[model samples]
Target: NLCSKNKINPLIGSAGVSAVPMAARVSNKVGLESDAQNFLLMHAMGPNVAGVIGSAIAAGVMLKYVLAM
Candidate 1:
């Protein structure tokens, strides 16, 4: 819904910590529906993993800041 409204790729839009490989799998499945050759699982991993690590780093930074206050 949000991806369609924003004109974003489903795989890219769905990349996140909780969603992770599940979202990538869904993207690949949907892509295969449209085109049998489509395989997005690996491609989606970069963003998915990055989102997880980035969130952890962000949380750490936020925690440090809050603790300093």
Candidate 2:
């Protein structure tokens, strides 16, 4: 819903799939396809890294909660 509201593809998470620099490279590659000068590797990586961190924290919290049940 948020992505649609902002006109962003909900499938954007694919860029963070591997959590590797290659993912960033792929991001730039995809952007280049749209516009040769458009580079999004660095910018996308910011959120990719943040997502990895957030996912780790979320996983930890879920583990704790599930174990407590």
Worst 10 residues of 2 by lDDT: 3-12
Give me the runs in candidate 1 sitting further than 4 Å from their true place: 1-10, 16-18
How does candidate 2 score on lDDT? 0.72
Q: Write the per-residue lDDT of candidate 2 for residues 1-69, one digit (tens) a residue.
A: 654556553224656654766777777788788878876777767767877788899899999999999
- lDDT score for residue 68 of model 1: 100
Backbone atom clashes (below 3 Å) for every candidate: 0, 0
Top model by lDDT, which number? 1
Top model by TM-score, which number?
1
For residues 1-69, write the lDDT of model 1, one tens digit per residue.
654556545555575554677867777788888888877778777787888888889999999999999
Q: Where does model 2 exceed 4 Å of error?
A: 1-18
CA lDDT, every prediction? 0.75, 0.72
